[model samples]
Target: MNRENVLVIGGAAGIGKQIVLDFAGRGKKVAVADINKKALDQLINESGRPNDIFSFEVDVSNWESVQNMMTKVKETLNSIDIFVYSAGITKQVSFLNIDWASWKKTIAVNLHGLFFSTKAVLPLMKNKNGGSIIIIGSGSAITGSGGGIHYAASKGGAFGFMRSLVGELGKEGININVIAPRVIESDMLDRLYPSEGSKNTLKKEIPIGRLGKPSDISNLTNFLSNEESAYIHGQIIIADGGRTFRPKSG
Candidate 1:
């Protein structure tokens, strides 16, 4: 098996870190990119077998920075086989209370960042005859949710971006897909909600009986980034433990 070179944006922590580690453990060369230099170093140090892990500090929200980071990753690792846009942010602001600045920031990170990161890597992937672009969306992207209208809108845009990119790039052998996860246990979750009881209650309401761990999403990402999913394109796979399908009886 030819080991794939994977570049995971926002891989310093959370689900993105898990994806980077998983790919590295499989003997693939992994580039962990993020704006958090300390966290990036922490992931590299924690990996133990550090040879497979490389760190690049890049803010995905900045188009030029992301482009430069992609160039460095390709130069250092030869060629990238997979690109994962696992970088995102969400806030629990009421629609009426969310100021334009806050909403714009959410859009920049959650939607625009995905666009910049994926666009930067597409050319490199096209040269290889194809590669996988995985965007981490959210359950809110599909359903109406309170207090996170901006977040939901950004994710909805991600779905649109993935499908459109797939249509235009599939002929070039590139596969684009979005994996929308339900509530997941990660630093982002901790920061966004910050209430343990609330988080726990939300987790229990899910049909899966627990919040998704970073590994759950990472496992799905691994599959989508591999040869097995070559024929799969432009699909939004919801890995929310059937939460989206449960009857709203309450």
Candidate 2:
């Protein structure tokens, strides 16, 4: 099999970091892009595959930054086989307390970033004649959350964007999909539920008896990037450990 050139945005921490590692473990050449240079350095150092893994400091919300990073990836890797958009931001703010600055920032990082990243890679992927684009979304888009209206709106837009792009991209042999994970054990989750007891209480409500792990989502991402998932497109695979289906009172 030809070694794939994978680009993971927001891949310096949490689920994005795990996805980078997963791709590298599978012998794929991985390029991780993030705004956090320290975290990117830590990820590259920890991987121990200096040649196979590279990092770029990129602000996904900025079009120029994303374009520059994409150009560098093309120059470095020759071609991009998989592109993952995992750059996002969210906060717990009541609807009444929401401000324009905060809302704009949330949408800029979450929705606008995805758009910029995807737009930057489309021409490259199209030139290659095949590629996969994966967007990391949230279940909050499905069942509205009180404290994260901007986050929910941004994620919901992601779903719509993927669905809209599949048809156009598919014609060019490119696949796009969204993976929505709920209550995942990630830095974002830590910020949302700081206490271990609080996490455990939420975990008990899941049918799987535990919170979703970064690996869980990365595993599916790996599959979706491979030929096995060629038939799947524009689909939103919810990785919530069955939390969405459980009764409200349960």
Q: lDDT, candidate 1, residue 184?
A: 80
Cα-based lDDT at residue 194, candidate 2: 88
The TM-score obtained by model 1 is 0.94
Q: Residue by residue across 22-120, what tens digits does model 2's lDDT show?
A: 999999999999999999999989999999999999988899999999889989987788999999888888899999999999999999999999888
For each candidate in turn, the TM-score is 0.94, 0.96
Write model 1 residue lDDT over 2-82, tens digit each, in one string. Answer: 437888888888999999988888888898899999999889889996788999999878899988998898889877778
For all candidates, the clash counts are: 0, 0
The C-alpha lDDT values of all candidates are: 0.85, 0.90
lDDT accuracy of residue 242 in candidate 2: 93
